[model samples]
Target: MSGETVITRFAPSPTGRLHLGHAASAIRAHDYARERGGRFVLRIEDIDGTRSRPEFVAGILEDLAWLGLRWDLLVFQSERLAKYQAALETLKARGLVYPCFCTRAEIAASASAPQGDAAPVYPGICRDLTVEEVTARAHLAHCWRLDMAKAVAITGALAWHDAIAGAVVADPLAQGDVVLARKDAPASYHLAVTLDDAAQGVTDVVRGVDLFAATDVHRVLQALLGLPVPSYHHHPLVVDAAGRRLAKRDGALSLAEMREGGEDGATLAARVRGGDRLATSW
Candidate 1:
């Protein structure tokens, strides 16, 4: 919309091989940048260190290369812990983020209703903890969750523009107090992505529609951190013949498997763009 040099990125977590769904998203981002003579970036979202394997990271790079996808810049989130920590501290100083020690079971038990497709909305269990109480739990394992209500009050009304969906208002409340830093990881996806997008100077974010809702939380983070908000374009997700969304755990046909079964990289990319359903066997 701004006619500025667009910067798009294909960020994938290296926990498994690239599947057809991943290919579609990558191709969309790459083409968006290429169409405008802009820069395309590749970011490895390996923040989940325990599950993020080096072999998977290597496989991701190889898969993208095989697909003829080129990136102007490459970054790994594992290497940017300090930056994320700094951003978290900035929020903490603003009294916008609080610690939450709730486990999965505890949260599910406390939630009043189902929270849109994902885990139930966090019910702000620890949002009003006293300083002494917070100090007492400092040594225990905990996560930093954004104080959604406080955040909204500070930022007031907010909105962002999307290419397909048009202008959208920010609704951080629906997401509840999203975790900024997890007990197991230095930063959560919402926090890392918002910071990384700003750090990379990305002008346009192109990805699947599944993440369209998550944009609300990201917008709040951008406003709280005083970071530039980028235009978003959430495309449709690739689904199997059964209409089930593709996922790594569902034994979806991976790019590596397709290549081994004699699929050409460029041809496969074209088929993906054309919305040709992939065979489960191949």
Candidate 2:
């Protein structure tokens, strides 16, 4: 991701209201790029149709603007299905993708796996399936999974310079096989994000440390798609007084709730900047 100017993005899923954590990310992305005379790209990660709301998206934009954090023309992940599909086809042609027909119960039966914020580690039961066999099984309900074995064979010991995490190595074993597409969403986070970052010519990625592990999966996909590798910065996550990471379920810490109690822009800004040192950290 070499360029005369740097480009960064704050891709937020509009599943809930913009809270302190959201403000921190938006401010950091906006300020970092602006500080270096670069571009700040805004991408709405609304692939999850069940939870993504238009009202929430609008409110997010409103909150960011209220904080005086402006971004470039907005891009929505929901609008880029064909691009993701084409990339999926490329992976398939390279024999780096297969269909997995495992239900929640069946996958659970493999092991009582440890959670990493998202679902448990997906067992590679179907990772070695042949394309024809996978195709036949695809007729039934199943999502597409990336063949990490083939992917790692193509790119060995992948590593990148993280702006904050220093040298980051891509761990193939921990990442294992990942889903590219699901029944509900057209594209998974791995596929959609990798395509969007490349398309936007992003020079660096700045997000919470929560996503540090996923970078390995993205790196492998980047190699498979022949896209440029951008520098990453996994900053500290914003946690509450209880030390729990802020989430959508933490409605009490929302900007809207604080605003309802007579907080203005400057007040919100101070709290956000002070709450987690969030602006500069992310």
Model 2 C-alpha lDDT versus the unseen true structure? 0.81
lDDT of each: 0.90, 0.81
Candidate 1 Cα errors over 4 Å, as ranges? 1-3, 114-117, 278-282
lDDT of 2 by residue, 127-156 (tens): 777768877886788888887877898888
Residue 257 error, candidate 1, Å: 0.8
What is candidate 1's lDDT per residue for 1-282, written digit by digit as tens? 566888999999988899988988999999999999999999999999788999999999989988889999999999899999999999999888999988999999887877665799888888899989999988989999999899999889989988999999978798889999999999999999999999998999999898998999999999888899999999988887667788766668889988999989998888777777655632
lDDT of 2 at 259: 67
User: Model 2 residue 85 lDDT?
Assistant: 89
TM-score of each candidate? 0.96, 0.91
**Candidate number with greatest TM-score:** 1
